[model samples]
Target: MIGQILINGLLNGFVYALVAVGLSLTWGVMDIVNFAHGEFLLWGMYAAFWIWSLVGLDPLISLPIIVVLIFALGVLTYLIVIRRVLKVSGLTALLATFGLSMVLKNLTQFFWTANYKNITNPLVSNKSFKVLGMYIRQDYVVAAVGALLLTMLVMAFMNKTKTGVAIKATSMNKQAAQLMGIDTSRIYAITFGLSGACVGAAAALMASFTPIYPEACALYSTLAFVIVALGGFGNIKGALYAGLIIGVAEALGGYLIGTSYKYLVVFLIYLIVIQIRPRGLFGW
Candidate 1:
């Protein structure tokens, strides 16, 4: 039972890592807290659902489409909302994102009616297979693997590519980067888009088993905030490790204590860690 729980926790940790990576990018790069991050995830799930429902495409098959669409959404958001407020105070950007979050949630509810829709008979089966004396869900395995691959891809991009280096440069010192001839505005838009892409991929992966609703990503978003903070702002490796720690803690907490108190355990661990290392595990 413990092994199974650990396996489950690890699988979930991978997905959580992906989600936090997205938030980390925007926060680290632009110093902007996107309160609408969860809503962006909600939209991705919706896009997958509508495509499957209307066009008979499986969530897995429609994954690329959903990702690209959400990437566009992120760019549009930066261009339309974030850019205008970039020169303003951080609080103004925060309020703007908060308002945007409200608008997005309401718009989703207005159109989808708060109904919990789901993909039926997805390409990835929802069955569990026994592995090394533990049962593992197939869909979850797929999601976990996808999340891991995507996270690695993001890390590689950051380390290997010219554009990615520019992004990092901008994140480290925007004024310096600007002086070096990097277009800070374009980089910001791209960062936002990349953020959305991460969540969009996560949404696609989760949509197979998760119920699609406006509030579906609510808990995820909240947890992501904790994950990003616990991991330290702008620390991708921190986010990844912190997510795994949270996932394990949540699983063990649920098993040892009660399901109702799982999140309590999560926060308690965060508090303890923060007291020990105020900047987080990987924060400099």
Candidate 2:
């Protein structure tokens, strides 16, 4: 039973890490708190659900399209909203994102309504396979694998590509990057795009099993804030580790205590860790 719980937690941790990574990029690179980040995930899920319902494509089959769409949304967000408030003040940027979040949530509710929607069937069947006396759901396994692959892709992009390097430079010092002809505005747009891409992929992977609704990702958004803080601001690797920890903690807490208090355990651990290392586990 413990082993099974561990497996479930590990799988969930990967997805959580993917979701938090997107928020990490925008926060770490642009120093912009995107209150609308969760809405991006909500939209991605809606996109996947609608495509599956209308076009008869599996979420996995439609994954790439959804990712690209969210990427465009991210770029548009930077250009249309974030860019305007970029220099006004941190508070202004924060407020802008908050307002944007409201707009997005309302738009979704307006078009789709507050009712929950879900994909009845997906390529990955809702079946579990037993291995070494432990059962793992196919959807969970696929989601976990996809999340890991996507996370690695993001890491490689940041480390290997010229644009990635420029992004890193801008994160470290925006003025310096601009002086070096890095085109900080373009980098910012790309960062937001990348952030949205991460969440979009996650949405597609999760759509097989997760319910679709405007508020579906609300809890995820809150947990993401905690994960980002626990992982250390702007540290992708840290976010991965922190996500796993939270996933396991949540599962164990639910089993050992109760589902009602599972999240309490998550927050308690975060509080204790922050007291010891105020900069977070990976923060500099």
**Which stretches of model 1 miss by more than 4 angstroms?**
none
lDDT of 2 by residue, 1-284 (tens): 99999999999999999999999999987889999999999999999999999999998999999999999999999999999889886499999999999999999999999998979969998799999999999999999999999999999999999999999999999999999999999999999999999999999999989989888999888888888889998899888999999999999999999989999999998999899987689999
Best by lDDT: 2
| Backbone clashes in model 2, listed as residue pairs | none
TM-scores for the candidates: 0.98, 0.98
- Which ten residues in a row are the worst by lDDT in model 2? 81-90
Instruction: Please report, in order, the local distance difference test score of every candidate based on alpha carbons.
Output: 0.92, 0.93
* Candidate 1's TM-score: 0.98
Cα RMSD to the true fold for all candidates: 0.9, 0.9
